[model samples]
Target: MSDGVATVHLVRSPARTVWTAIALSGAFLLAGCGSQADLAKVNHPRTVVPAKVVQKPQPNTPPRPVEPVFAPERLRAVDPCALMDTQTLSAFGVPASSRAVALSDCGNYMKDGAGKRLSITLRLGQNVLISDTAKTTKLAGLTTVESTSTTTCFVKSVVQEGSVVLGIVAQVDYEGDSCDVGRRLNESAINRIRTNAPLRPQGNKGSLTSVDPCAIFSPVTATEVLGGTPSMTPYDLYRCNWRRDSLSFGIEFAENTDPKNSSANKKAEVVTIEGVTAYQRKDDSFGNSCKIEWLHKATTDGKGEVATVSVDNTKKGVDIDLCAKATTVAKALVPKLPKP
Candidate 1:
């Protein structure tokens, strides 16, 4: 751990030189004691020798502190749908529907004069990705990257950069030149985020926007289901995942239609956990995984906000019942959620 060097200086023959000086002084004294004539014959001259200076070792320098990244709590508080308001949507075309897909993503769907579908999406606090072919620019004083495909164009402004990068993105899907719309929307979003990004509805006590998904279950519960201590990873405040060996578990909160009416879950088994109706889906398309979802509350747009518990057992030849394990986690999760 020592990152410094100590310097030492040594004079050659210093002990011998000191002894020779002492012997010469003693001989002069003895000769002086014998007679005054001898004292006069002995002549001694003073000589000065300079000592080498040794520098003290310096202490190790402390490591530099890491600079804090940009994390806007206000961005998390604002509703995703609020970014694409009536005026903003009308600028492009007549708006058909606007809805939140996730906690931080929203879509404003419109129709072109030829009846082709056009859409604008605003995404906040999202994971950043830039490809080699992507073009770079600046928006609202932040570094922005723009990527285009055959049908879609995306412009994202970097909000934080380091081990993990996060950004705010504006996406446009159109057959024509989509980057123009994307750039315009990105600028508008960045300005709104700076000055006046509309916030979520106030005083909704049952909302899960402020909850941390990783804190929902106890350690004992995690260990029991994962078969050991698991690594907990949070994709965001509303979603968390766990993994230990071949066993994996996850919990998520999102905006979705009701479980009973959702097309994706039409074949899902209807069940009840913690006295609330829930739908269970067993998917073997990739591995043995079971997902249980239940409605937490209804939003103002008639769509239900829901929570999910997913358990996957990928170990070969293991006789674990995935659905039962998913149910157990859901049972513990239901009581922790805020009641509507």
Candidate 2:
């Protein structure tokens, strides 16, 4: 050993060796814990910054109000001639051929205050077949016109195969010099004629009234005596066909007859102007007089079988007096047969 220096020797034992290792680990663990605590404290003292706010951009102005694209005035001014031509061609069922003729233009037609126009055209075949073309400016007032002016053109070739007679007549009227208005009027008139023409029959064979005077006779001109337009009212005339074997009977009366006043009732009476004998009978139920007529004829021509009755009306035309004055003039006038 050297002077002032001490030399210590460590003895190796199992227990002491283990204890020494544990102490070294504990010290290292304590140092690590101390470092984590100091770091946490230091971070807690620092201030935190808030995130920035970003705003969305606003639209500069509200969207402008949308306007309707179509106006009624603009529609009214649109050229209708093209539309008319298209419709007419469609109706003809054929392409515009040289044989087809254009009678009038839109210029000569008239326009109403609403700027509506009318135009007309007529096409005919070799057999007098007629086809009418009407062009209208306004769709609303097409049916207002009574008549129209139409152009007539004859087709060199026959379009249809049938026995038909076609004739067209047109009358055009205009407020001004617009052909468009005239065309529309013509179209309306033609359409009406076409609809109404089909209703008229050439003969009265299947109709309610008899056309042959020998088959039937009108006691009086029912149409004239009735005194009203047939088109406006329901009053109509019908001929009663005569049958020698069957008895012909009818009931007639005044329109407004009052039974309380016999004089008024007498004034309003129905008389047979021709064909048969008539008489008035008082009906107790309605206090009215009912006029009835019956004709029984054995002869075929009804020469001696005819009778005439007259009805006289009061000054006011309210009361009528029906009298049955039978005359044998028809019988006397009938030709006598030669001795057998």
Candidate 3:
């Protein structure tokens, strides 16, 4: 100690200065053992810490893809009606006659003596993913749902392993339980699958799945038949209506029923359209003035593809007015049909 004024000291070391500069640069930082720091003396020391190393992050993995439910090759030739056994259909009041709509779908009208009825339509493989809400069922290792909206109800079963979806659509107009009807339809179809029913009976070539009735004619020919570019409403793969102004007509392919047996009620005559024999029948049953049926594909009992051309000439008698136009349309359509 000196006087009350105080004392001053200054010291500079090359080693200390170089070390301080290195520490400030911070090229490497780590924890180390240290004691104290004396500012007045040359005993200042720095605190040290362990080296902190950081690593760059990696990207996350992608999710696995969903497996497909079915194989295209195995199902390409399947007939929708083949899925339902005849016994099952008869149990549900399905007549020997089931209405075909396209290749893999058909309906049996549960009709009363009167014209009123509910329809149970069976479809194969049209829908893959169906969400179940109000009703669901498990049958034959498949998930089924009974989904209804006001007028119609559908019960669908998903066979995931086989990648096949069997659907049963029914109207609520029938007696007894609606779901029961749908379940019956689905169970019958599933049972047929278990037994491995043939895609089609032997010697049966299959349906005319390739026919587009509305597009069978040229624009010029259609204009002549329809009187203009016909407003077309297609009802699946088998039927379509072409309408223009006061004239309306439809083209349809009927399977399993021969027009020969069906022509009893109507005045019928065999007419030639494009060299193929077709029956021309006049009946107002469906407001169809003229109906001309020709063969398309075949089944049995003279049963096969019965293509029909129907025209609406409500006021005109069936003589030449409706029949002439009907014949014209039929002739144009015959050449475009897929081979039986």
lDDT per residue (tens digit) for residues 190-249 in model 1:
665555545676887788775667776777888888777886654433556667777777
Q: What global local distance difference test value does model 3 have? A: 0.47
lDDT of 2 by residue, 125-188 (tens): 1112122332112222211111222322111111112222111112223334323332333343
- The worst-scoring run of ten residues by lDDT in candidate 1 lies at 18-27
Show where candidate 3 strays beyond 4 Å: 1-78, 85-103, 106-206, 263-266, 284-288, 314-320
On lDDT, the stronger of 1 and 3 is 1
Scored by Cα lDDT, where does model 2 land? 0.21
Candidate no. 1 TM-score: 0.70
Model 1: lDDT of residue 160:
52
Instruction: Specify the poorest-scoring 10-residue window by lDDT in model 3.
Output: 18-27
Question: Which number leads on lDDT?
Answer: 1
Best by TM-score: 1
Candidate structures ordered by TM-score, highest first? 1, 3, 2
Off by over 4 Å in 1: 1-73, 90-97, 111-117, 132-135, 160-164, 300-302
Per-residue lDDT value at 312 in model 1: 76
Q: How many pairs of residues in model 3 come into backbone collision?
A: 8
